[model samples]
Target chain A: MIRLLEHEGKALLGRRGFAIPEGALFPGLPPTGPWVVKAQVPVGGRGKAGGIRFAATTDEVRAAADAVARLVIGGHDVRAVYVERRVPPGREVYLAAHVDRDLGCPVMLACPAGGVDIEAVPHERIARVAVDPLAGLGDEDAAMLARALSPDGPPPPALRRAVADLYRTLVEEDAELVEINPLIVGADGTVTAADARLILDEDAAFRHPGRRAIPEGTAFEEEARRRGVIGIELDGDIAAMMNGAGMTMATLDQLVAMGGSVRGLVELHGAMARGPDHLAGVVALMASLRPRVLLFNIYFQFRNLDTVAEGIARAIHAAGPGGLPPVVVRIRGVREAEARRILEPLDCWVTDDFARACARAIELSGRPVLRR
Target chain B: MAILVDARSRILIQGITGETGRAYAARMVAAGTPLVGGTSPGKAGQAVEGVPVFATIAEAVAATGADCVLSSVRPAAALAAMTEVFEAGIRVAVLYTENVPVHDAMRMRALARARGACLLGPNSAGVISPGRANLADLNDARVRAGRIGVVSKSGTLTYEVIDGLHAEGLGESTVVCLGGDPVVGTGFAEILRLFEADPGTDAVVLVGEPGGAMEHEAAAVVRTMRKPVVAYVTGQRAPPAKRMGHAGAVSGAGAEATTAAAKLAALRSAGCTGVDIVTDVGAAMVAALAARRGAHAS
Candidate 1:
């Protein structure tokens, strides 16, 4: 999942027929004055972090943008600022639509008290309804959420329409979540989205042709993600790879338990679909970490293990004269005999035992120098 | 006698003509899974591993009386493929495609609920009742039929538990993969209830990880279950907010409830043995079952 920056999210909301404050990215201010200069970063709590600054007039907007640009919220450097015409604060209400992972269904949520942290909002204060995956968030349901948030009597038609629009954006854009925090309800009963937080499902990248998602993680992790593999960088001496996410975590747990320091970890997702050469590239990426020991813990059920072994063998050969870090491999499961044969001639320590292999990885991490 | 799939299930593959589908079809047939027919759009009347392929799920169901389906289509086709299976009246459906969009999964889950059909993962490893049914992605040779029912979100994690179980000379009665996605079709609570009712399952191993309240949901079920449960959550050393391969495996940065440690503690407090280490689960399971048997004897 990739969380879109506020400007990007607003652009999407504006396109999807939702009322968003007119905003422009850095260098180009929106056509109106009395704006809020907000730093564009994926992380939340930007307001508390001083990433948002209020401004009036073109001069004030420029000054606010400069100040906001200097601020870093949650370790993300403010590379750009979103300048949007400020919607006059009447009542800050919150609205959102997302799949409730716990409830196992799509849901629409709203609260009268919004601008603050929603998590802090009492459960009873917030109004939520499970969106019938079949019927979707209908007109009645939207009115229900609006009425619940209002609580006095009835809500404005625009508020009800906004509630429905939020759910529509969530489904139509293939977004995991579409949240409007501080959905300002004006005195005239107009609903304006003060901020938009959208997380697009990366798997639906195929359907969205031109939409660009912000890249995450370190340089190595970004490279790994580009190759359709999950890689994480740590501060240690061993770089390990595994076939599945669970196995990867379990291997990390075991290695850490045995006093092995991990420098990086990679889950060789779709190893079979991505052939040996592609796997070799991932191996090379792991080797570039220059860890003391390189580890691979692979277990396959229907997948061929030899494909992984072949990938390792190819990486060993492709590393050329410098070779690779001291390789420790724990490979098992389907096509084991063939997989072992492929790894036999390589300069690596191969084992079928998980504990023994992790132990060996730590032991090798303690070694002084690599002979290769 | 297993909870979900068994010897009597007439299973079908949604994308049986594709490479992955064809491969699983062959493996299913070789392992003696009751694979009746499959759906491959234009490949109707054709065969993969001697099982007939239909143009659509309705045709396959009508012709073969298939009630279970294993869908091996692409992520883009995940929603449509699942809709076909659920609409065809398949009681059990496993969406094997990985990287399926969450909205698509939600729609699929809703369809499953509306139809009263059991829907497994869009990225699930599938289910297996050992020698009885081979709906799971595992090789039948690796797992032996036994009295312990194993339900996990990860097929790979299940392997570690199975290996640990082997160390204690224990095998599984039924192995169910709930899928690795954050929004999956089923959860631990529902599966635990099924295992609780199964006559063959004496104990159950609930394998979970960080993130989501699914484990907490299961903790509620564990308190009332007659059978013993052993909970092992991975990512003990996982950095918070880091997506640990499985999209659902991330530990919420500040929220204590979604972390692996907190989840394990919740399950343990509910009166089940919770182990931090993966390899220790089997030994814990053995001890739990023993204690239960001792109580029964008394």
Candidate 2:
């Protein structure tokens, strides 16, 4: 999921014909008097973290932007501030559209009580409708959401249209989530999105050529992304490499349970499909973490183990003697004998038993194996 | 008879001209898995390694009477390919594409449910009923046909469990890779229900990971099953909020319901034995089977 900044999200919504407060990314201010300066970060709880400020004058707006730009909320550095013309806060409501995993459908959720935490909102206040992916958000469904937002009377056409357009943006943009917290209903009966949080589906990036640049996460993550391997860093001495995500986690759990801590783990997610050289590059990247022991717990179904073996051999040859860490390999499935034959020349302990291999990795990491 | 695919299942490969599709076709044919025909749009009349190719699934089905489909279309075209498969009355489909848009997945799942068809995955490694069929990614020679049924969210984890079971002198009746997606077409509960009714299946080994309520749903079905269930929920030590390779394998904020610990507890409470270590899964399955046998003997 690529989380879009407030301005980017608003711009997307605005393109799809949704009403949004006029805003500009600071160091430039919007041509207006009253403004809300918000730190443009991907995470939530920015308001509570003092990342949001209200200004009534040009000097105050400049000061607010400066304050917000310097603020770091939720460990993310605020690179920019979103300055928007402040609408005199009226009835605050919450509206969002996202793919609900449980419902197995695109769902539209709306609540009359919005500005506050949606999690804390009373169950009765929240109105949700599962939009059929085939038919999309129907007229009845939009009206139902509108009624839920305004219980005393029928909702204005603007609210209904906004709700429908929000769903449109969510579907058309291939977004995972599009949320508007405090969807403000002004005193003059105008509905506008005060804040936007859009998460585009990374899987659907092929359809979106102009998708915003992905923010660099951790240094290890950036390197992993560049290398096309999944590398997750942990605070331990053992480095583990596995074929799939679930297996990687399972190996980590088993290693940790046996008194071994993991320095990092690299998941061979289709990396081996590119052949031995690509796999070697991934291994070289994993070695950069400087782990005490490198553990390979690979269980390939369709993928040949010989490819992985050749990759490990290439990585070892590239690193030279004593440059690489002590390695323990537990490989099975698809050309196991051939893979073992390829790795025999390397200074590595190869086995088919997962437990023994894990124990060896822990011992090499200088940790005593825990007896149950 | 095997649960999903058997000797009777006439298989068709969608996107049969693609690299992955060609690989699956060759393996399935070599394994003698009743590979009847295939379909690749604009590649009609082209025979891929002795298998007849058609332009669409309907044409393939009409020609070969294909009951099951192995869909290897790209992520962008996966949904359309699945629509073709389901619409052509294909009862079972193994979607081999990964990274399908979540909305597309939802719709595909809905279509499958509406048609009462079994759609395996949009990211799935597919399923295999050892010796009987070779629709999955597993090399048929390595998988010995036997009585214990296997269902898992992860493809590689299934290999680990299979190896562990082999060490305990156990083999599988069928192995289903549910795919590691947040919203998959098939879930643990559905597969558990199939294993429960399968005469060849005496026990089940469920390989689960941290994240998703599929395990919770599986527990609900396990509570009613007479067959013994042994479970290994991985990612016990995974850091919270980190996507551990699989898109669905994430420990989200404050949602303990999807955590590995919680999933293990649910399975245990449902009268299933849970293993803390991955290698111990075989031992746990052996114990559960022993207990079931003891109950039967009495």
Candidate 3:
């Protein structure tokens, strides 16, 4: 999930007719008398990052922009600065919409005290509503959220309409997160999404290319992608290969709990669909993991084990005994006999035992599998 | 007593002409899993692994009385496969395909629900009632039918757990991998409900990873269950969710989706025994069973 800066986020909101402060991302400060120079980064806490500075004079604006642009925090590059006319202080409120992984729908969360960290808001103080994709967020729900934020009365028709439209834009754009922190409802009672931060899911990038063109993944992700293996390097050393993501992660967690270091993780969900060449790629990749012992713990519910076995066998043949790492194979599910037959030739200890498989992996690595 | 499939269940294989469907058909037949028939749109007049082939689910069901289906269609063709099975009135289906479009998953899920069919997965590893019948991506030779009901989000993890149980001189009543997707058809809670009702299932072992609320939802159900459930949550120290193979593995913005610590806490708070290491899963199940026995005796 990549975070869009406040300026970009607000610009999108403004384009969608949401009340937003006009902002511009400039390499250098505009020749102006008054402006706020804020460091442009994806993460929050920029104000505390010593990156937010106000400049009343044109010369001051240039210097502030220059300073803010050069500041880097938390490894995020700061090459640009946001210049905008500062709005007068008013009651700070917050609104955010995101996909609730558990409920399996979009959820809108709001709180009246928003300028502060949203995380700091009391759980009960936060009001939440689920938005069904099939049925769009209706008027009553938007008005309810507005009322929750403004308990005294309903938000004006314009603000209510804006809120509803913003929610619609969020769904239409296929966004994972569209947050407006300190959605200032000014003393004059005008509501504006003062800070707009959006995070769009990369998986849905194909449908919404306009705002969803995800930047190339990080270096680690790119490297993993090239291998056709799901490589998630963690703080441990016992690299593992499994058929599914949940299994891969569970193995890593188990190894970590057992006090073994896990250097990498690979989930071959569709590798069974591929042939020996795919397995060869996996073996070569595992060799790169530099694991003291590679764990081939595969459980197929409907996939053929022979495919995994063949892949491992071919990879071992390609790597040769000297190049291959000490390997332990714990396989189950359909085509087991055939898969084990293939792995047996590669000196892989084929077992249908979970503990034994893990023990072998740990033993070969000369490590203890910790328990938690 | 089983929730979805049992010893009496007859199974049908959809997409039986495909390489994957054929492979599973051979294994299921070899395992003596009450193999009935298969369905492939244009391969109706043939036989796969001695199982009669029909062009449609209705014909296959009529010919073999097969009430359960293992769908092995491609992602793009998943909906059509499901529609065929659903229309045939199959009571249970395990969709073994992944990367299906989200819009398709929703529509298929709704269709399955409307038909009162229990759809295991859009990316599921299928379900196995141990020695009774096997209709999943799992290795038939490795699983032994017994008392423990193993439910997981990963097929490999389910195998690992089943292997652990085998080493302990135990086997599964049924092992179900709900699939590793955010928008999967079946969930932990629904599977737990099945385990709670399965007379053959003495206990349950739940394996989950970071990046979904399914585990947490299951934890809530476990709090009210009569059976014992042991859970293992992965990605404890997993550096935040990294996008790679599975679409469901992506971390949603929540404490429940991306953090193992949070999931583990929820399980524990819900009164379910939570273990961190996969290797300890067997021991946890044993302890849960023992604890249940002690409580029963007292």
Candidate 4:
């Protein structure tokens, strides 16, 4: 699921008739008296990264926006700056609605302390209430949760009912996360969802039309996704490919365990339907990652390895002279020898030991391979 | 003895006129799995693989005495399809459709439970009693009928595990794919209970990915089972927080939703015989079976 930035999240809240601070994303901060220039990013801990800054003057707002927008968090480029009207300090109240998972239903969680990280909140203070998908949130429970958040005024009865309805909004829409941090209760008894954060589960996207666009992928991730494979860019120097999500992760862990850096990861999914051409695409993609070594730890049951091997051979030939990553393949099940026959001709090292393949990957990376 | 299905089981194919339905129907009939007939809304009097087709499941069951059904309808129509099968009084059913709404799954699950009918998957690959019944996505040529019982959420991984077992001279009595979706109609624990009671099932090999408490819950059942269980949890080395594939694989922090290590550890603590990789599944199965035998001798 792609995380919606705070600005977009707050706008969604606004559409749902919730109170939120006026926000705008701007290429440059306009000449304004005061504004909060926050970096629009998907990663957490942005406040600690100095991505969130309060600007007292137009020049400061412009400077902060320009500076923070250039910063990268979790490898994602911060393209635009989220500028908003800063709210006055008040008591922090936290509220979130998410699927409890274990209960197999949506749950609403609320606590009086909100501005700080929810994880850091004391367990006893956090109150959880399961919302029935069919019956929805009852009025009494909503009031209790809202009262638990603010004992003094305890959110007006109507507001508590609204909060309950918001939970319904999250569940029926298949939202993975709906968080309101520091639900500001002004001295006038006005309740506002001050900080909004929502993450909609992508698997349930068919239910919410036009909620998301077909996401753009990085050069590596795009190639892999197109082949119905999972791909991720990493900092390591070894480019690794494997069959199945489970094996891809194991290979990555093994590489990290062996003191090797993984540059990229490609997982071949539904490999039987995917012919040798998909394998060829994988080889070319790994070559583009420009790793010192390419590792394939494929374990197949019904799928044939001959097609995969043939694809790699074609990719190697297509790579031109010295165009391939020094390969280390560990293939098992369904035509092992035929796969080996295809790869052995390319001069790629072939083995079945996961650790050995990793060690070879490190060695070929021209780095001192550290023993696990 | 095997679990859920065997050679004697009579099966019916719902939506047999559809491409996937027709394909599996032909394979099942060809493999000689007592596929009596098929049901399509408007395809009555037609034939799929020379098996008579009826417009409704009741008519098909009345004519052929079919006990099992493989539902291959689309996601939007899966619940209705299963409901129709249940109404027809089918004892067991397998739903091969994915993307079923959560509410639909809940209704189907509740209806199946109330009716004393066993539902395999909303997104499941139909169960196979190799050499006897071929009602699944797995190719019969790749499998052998034997004493092992295999249950998994992944179709390809199930094929991999069964292939490994076959390589070790073991054959499965029934291989059930519980489905890879988060809110599938049935779960690992429920299937384990059925396997435990099945006379044909000598042992069970459970293939699980990191997600849900299904494996952990199943582990609790395995702790008390007389039959040996070898549990394999995939995604042990999954990228810490990045969801790879499968909706069920997503997890929350410190919550054991979908961490392979956490799942494996939980399974072990609950007295399950655990293996980390597919390659080691056969060896683990052997080890578990040996322990069971030793316990019996003692």
**Highest lDDT among the candidates is held by which one?**
1
Predictions' DockQ, in order = 0.77, 0.78, 0.40, 0.25
lDDT, candidate 2, residue A326?
Answer: 98
Candidate 1 local accuracy as lDDT? 0.88
- Expressed as tens digits, the lDDT of each residue in B112-192 for candidate 1 is 988999999979999999999888778888898899999999998888898888889998899999999999999999999
Interface RMSD of each: 1.2, 1.2, 3.4, 3.9
Ranking by TM-score: 2, 1, 4, 3
Cα lDDT for residue A110, model 2?
Answer: 97
- Residue-level lDDT of model 4, residues B1-298, one tens digit each, is 6666776788899999998888888788778888888999978999999999999999999999889999888877887888899988998898888667665665576677767998877767778888888778787877888888898887767766786787688988888988766666577888888888987788888878776787777777878887888877776656565565565665545665457788778777777787765656787888888888898899
The lDDT ranking, best first, is: 1, 2, 4, 3
TM-score of each: 0.95, 0.97, 0.81, 0.84
Q: Highest TM-score, which number? A: 2
RMSD of 3: 4.7
lDDT of 3: 0.76
Model 1 ranges off by over 4 Å:
A151-153, A320-323, A367-372
Considering summed lDDT, which 10 consecutive residues are worst modelled in model 4 chain A?
A: A26-35
lDDT agreement with native, every candidate: 0.88, 0.87, 0.76, 0.76
Candidate 4 lDDT, A1-372, residue by residue in tens = 657888888887877778777667875443454688887776666777888888897778878888898898766778578887777666668888876544555678989887888888889989899765545678878888988887776477545855776786686666767888868766666677766777776655566777663354577787677767778877678888887554565566567656777888887766447687767877887788888888887766556878878887788888876888688888876788888887887778987555678788888888776772
TM-score of 2: 0.97
Q: Model 3: per-residue lDDT, tens digit, A1-372? A: 556777777877888878776567765444443677788787777888888888787677778887887788656778568887676787788888876656656788878788888887789998899876556687788888888788767676665666687677767666668898878887787887767788765544556556444344555445656666666665455667877676777766666666677767777755556687877787677668677877877766565778888888888888876787787888876788988778776767789765567767777788765542
